[model samples]
Target: MTSIGIVGSQGRMGVALAAAAAEAGHGHCGVDKDGDVGALAKEANVLVDFSSPAALEQTLDACVAQGRPIVIGTTGLEERHHYLIDDAAADIAVLQTGNTSLGVTLLAHLVREAAARLDPAFDIEIVEMHHRMKVDAPSGTALLLGQAAAEGRGIDLGDCSERGRDGVTGARGHGKIGFASLRGGTVAGDHDVIFAGPEEILTLSHRAENRMIFARGAVRAALWLLHQKPGRYTMPQVLGLGEA
Candidate 1:
């Protein structure tokens, strides 16, 4: 059985991945936080991180040092962290995504295709809801959808994204992708992508009823990554849904 290590092992996602790993008959090597990331990387076949952004560099450094592949489900990452992952991918296999649900992965692909087909006349907006415990606003899944829309439109997400607006916010910009977030209760996750045109509106959505789907996807990603060459990859690639 492949040995799997969990970073942020005490968190919700970590716990889910642990249970999934056990059910998959994989070895639960160890879990780490502030103690020794490098140790877990050295001992495990692959590391699964759903940890905080503060621990990202530590985990990446350890994985690179040990030449271990990693499945990063960590959210709330910055541009610098993405750059770090890209750099590390040159040495070790790395798969990263905001959400690991296979359904969400396919949803992103659909969103991309829809965006590509629609013209600039259609306004795109992404809204997501998560549990109250989630720390990030505009949930990573929302950003993922926005990224997909931007990709289809042949624009940069950072430049086109319109995140959380407050009072005095003016009219929505043309061709801009907006985001809205809601947090309450124990909602696993819910995301909607709306494309509003002159008289017609189209919406694509995906809802997660439980965390198990994410756990299963992460494990599947880890297993596939074990045999992949050094590089950065996404869930679409792991599932062979790379083509439009």
Candidate 2:
């Protein structure tokens, strides 16, 4: 049985992950702010971080110091945080993703495939909804789907992403991937990828009912990380959808 280390133990996802670890017949230890991160890393065989972006560096440092593999389920990360994850990945197994639910991972795969097969006349729009407490707009999962679409279309997401449109926006840019975010009552998560062609609309969606899906998926990812070499990984890889 693996000893799972939980970063942000007090958060919602952390609690769920602890329950998941127990259900999986694995032992777990957790740490929050002001806790002994290094000690936690040393005590556990692998780490799962569902913590805030601000604490990512410290969590990564502890994992690297102990040569532990980590599954990062944290959302709302910036470009700089990615650089930090990349640096740490050079020496340890790191699976970083915006969403961990297996269904969402599959949805992203399908979105990429659809984007590649459809003609440019189809306009792409991604919509996501989360709990009101969620701070990030567009949700990380939406961005993940956008990245897949961009890849299928052979374009850079940063260059073609159209978000936060308000008063007097003239027209959708050619080949733009549009995004819309909705925040409301206690939504676990919901994402829809819509492709509007000449006269038809194709929509792909995934709805998360609770935190357990993410928690269970993270455990699965951590299990995969254990046998992997030091490198960065993704949810798709965890599902064996290599390079899809």
lDDT per residue, candidate 1, 60-147, as tens digits? 9999999999999999999899999999999999999988899999999999999999989999999899989988898888988899
Give lDDT per model, in order.
0.91, 0.94
How far in Å is the alpha carbon of 115 misplaced in model 1?
0.2
Worst 10 residues of 2 by lDDT: 235-244
Q: What lDDT tens digits, residue by residue, belong to model 2 across residues 182-237?
A: 99999999999999999999999999999899999999999989999999999999
TM-scores for the candidates = 0.96, 0.98
Off by over 4 Å in 1: none
